[model samples]
Target: MSKAIARRGIMLVLSSPSGAGKTTIASRLLEDPGIELSISHTTRPKRKGEKDGKDYHFVDRETFTRLRDQDAFLEWAVVFDNYYGTTRKPVEEALAAGRDVLFDVDWQGARKLRESAKDDVVAVFILPPSAAALEQRLRTRAEDSDDVVKRRMRGASNEIQHWEEYDYVVVNTDIDQSVASVRAILAAERLRRTRLSGLKGFVQTLLATL
Candidate 1:
C-alpha cells in the first residue's frame, strides 16, 4: 500500500537593522522559483515604488486594530510607529498547498511568528558588520529624515540584541555572500527528511515496482 504525500511548507524569515542588507537579500530570494512573499497588512504610509498587496496591504489604523481584535493575524508588530501584521488565513492556505513563505520583518514580528507557528518557521537574522557602516548606508540612502535615521540607529542596537533567538544569523559583509548564505540555508531546509512530503509515497511506489 502507498502512503499519502504529506503537505508541508517553510516560513523563511529575514530580519536586520535598518541598513543591514536584509531587504536586498529578501528581494533576491523572492525571485527564486516557488517562493512566495508574505504580504503583510500595515497601517503605515507607503513610500515611493511601494504598492498595496505587493509591498504591503495598506490599511487604516482602525481596520488594523479591528483585525487584531478579531485574532486574525498570525504575527503582528509595531515598528517605527507603524503597525504591521501577517494575516493567518493566507499563510495557512499557502502552507497547506505546500508553498514556502518568505517574511521580511523585524525581531518583534519574528518572535511573534515563532510563538504562533514554530513548527514551520526558520528565522534568519542579518546584521551589519559595524555600526559605522550601518550609519553610512542609512545616510547614503537619503530616504529618512535625520530624526528617523537616529531612531533607526537606536533600534538597530535593540534588534541586534535578539540575534541569539533566531535559528540562523548572517553578518551581511557582502551582498552576494549574504544572499548565497541564505540560499544555502533554504536549500538545506528543503532537504529535511520530514519536509519531503511526497517521498513516502514515492518510496512505496518504488517498492511495488521492485
Candidate 2:
C-alpha cells in the first residue's frame, strides 16, 4: 500500500504590460483543475461582460479602503487611480490545501506578494514582441477608448522596465507557444523540493521497506 504525499502549493504570478497577453495566457492555464485563479477585489468599474465575484469583487472606494485598513489583502496596489487587492484569507487557504493560485497582477502587486511570501512565489513576466504589436493589440481589442489606450501604451514602457526583477520572462510572439512555455514553468515549479511537504516522510517509509 502507498500513502498519498502531501504538497504545498505555489503562488504563480504572471505580470505584463496592458496588451502583452498575460490575461489570455492566464485564461488558458485556468483550464486545469489543480490550479485556481486568485480573484482580486478592485474599485475599478466592471467592464462589459464582467461578472461580479467571478472577474473581480467589485466594490466602492469606501469598502476597498476599509479592507485595506484592516490588512485583509495579501497584496494591494493602486493602478491608474483604481485600487486592486488580493484577499489574504482565500489565497492562504488555497495554498495550504495544495491548490496553486494564479495571479494576474502588475509589477507593484508582484513585488508585494514576493515581499510577503518569497518562498512560495514563482514570478513570470510576459512581454510583447514589439512596441508596434503591443499598440496594435490594444487598438484591436477595443476594450478601452483612444485616451485610455494611449495611457496604457505609455504605462507599458514603465512596466517593461521591471522585467529583470521577475524569475522568468516570456516574449509572447505566439499565443499557443507562450502558453505552452508558461505551462512548462508551472510543471517544473511544482516539482520543487520545498513545495513537497511529505517528501521527507515518504522517502523515510520507502527506505524502511527496503
Which candidate comes out best when scored by TM-score? 2
lDDT of 1 by residue, 65-144 (tens): 99999999999999988999999998999888888999999999999999999989999999998999999999998989
Q: How would you encode candidate 2's per-residue C-alpha lDDT over 92-138 as one tens digit per residue?
A: 99999999999999999999999988998999999999999999999
Model 2 bad stretches (over 4 Å): 1-3
lDDT score of model 2? 0.95
Which residue runs does candidate 1 get wrong by more than 4 Å?
1-7
Task: Tell me how candidate 1 scores on lDDT.
Answer: 0.91
RMSD of 1: 2.5
User: Candidates' lDDT values, in order?
Assistant: 0.91, 0.95
Number of clashing residue pairs in every model? 0, 0
